[model samples]
Target: MSAWVFDLGNSRLKCAPLGEDGRPGDVLAFAHDGRALDAGWERALPMRIEAAHVASVAAPALRVALLEALSARCARIGLASTQRAWGGVRIAYAAPERLGVDRFLAMLAAHSRGGAWLVVGVGTALTIDLVDADGRHHGGRIAPSPALMREALHARATQLPPVGGHYREFATDTDDALASGCTGAALALVTCSGEAAAQLCGRPVPVLLHGGGADALRPHLPDAVHAPALVLEGLGCWAQVGRTP
Candidate 1:
């Protein structure tokens, strides 16, 4: 029997089948507009899956809808939630529940690689987390993502466009300036966080980038590894343990 894992984020919904080794297989993604999903989207899923493991940071409406759809096609369903510790990763949060499941999952995936890491997720938000080689989560930071920053600026100023324009060190036009500023802000945060993580962990850490907006920043940070399926990869681990929250 084959199982599937789902990662429902603020802007998109991603899913993948579990492989024989319990890792995620080819991933499929769909844009989420906070509306009811259509039958065509549902048809894209396997006709029948042995089980479904979901890690959702989306609104309740979409979460419930996706679960309802999976219930009919899956023998069992597992929902992921933040935990103090899982698979070797020890979260630093005093109240584990306050931590985002997506962040926790990304940390889990990073820890599984057996090294110190700085996990960065760039989507609706920019999230940074630090984990030592022994799986001790040092903590993390969150701020508006580059796209969100651009959107907020456009919303407030009206003169600035939310999208388009390439990033430059010294942008000449308004559009390019907007792009450079927002993206540079995010990069600065990541850079500062990396330096702090190095100090706290007593060594430099590798950066693992994920989420929808990661690509936009990848060229700037040449050392970071792009792992778009990171959340799903963590969900795969959650499924393997047969744990639900």
Candidate 2:
């Protein structure tokens, strides 16, 4: 039986086929802002599916819309949520629900690879989490992404462009300066976090970068692994364990 996984974030909805080997296949993304599903997007789904697993951090209305859409073509549907412990990973949150499931799934996926890791998600917001080699969650930090910073700055100061600029150590123009400063801040945070995580874990913690904005920061950090489909990969892991809501 064929299955599928969906990750609904604040900015986009991503889906992929779940292969028998328990890995996510090619991903498809649809950008939305609490609107109805696109006609083409609906048409794009497989005609029928054995199971549909979803991890959603979008608004409730949007989540409902997606679930409704899946109900028709999916023989079974599973909604994923944050958990204190699951599939070998133990979360640090006093209230596990406080942590975003996307983040949890990313850490879960990272732990499956068998090593301490500094997982960074750069999307609508920048989120960083650390999971030790033994799957112990070390909590994390959150900050506005470069794009969000740019948008906020543009909203406050119209003279500053909201987008379009290259990152440089010392930018001469205002646009590049804005881009450099915002991107630099995110890079610095990740670098600092990685160092701290290494000290705490007593080993070098490799960085794993994911999310839509990751490519912008990838060139700056050569060592970080780019895994854009990490959340979906983790969702696949979740389904593999037979836990679904």
lDDT tens digits, residue span 3-94, model 2: 99999999899999998878899999998866665667978888999999999999999999999999989999999999999989999999
RMSD of each: 1.7, 1.5
lDDT of each: 0.90, 0.93
Q: Where does candidate 1 stray beyond 4 Å? A: 243-245
lDDT string, candidate 1, 77-180, tens digits: 98999888888899999999999999998888887778999999999999999989999998899999999999999899998899999999999999889889
RMSD of 1: 1.7
What's the true lDDT of residue 73 in model 2?
A: 93
- For candidate 2, list the clashing residue pairs, or say none: none
Off by over 4 Å in 2: 243-245
lDDT of 1 at 17: 94
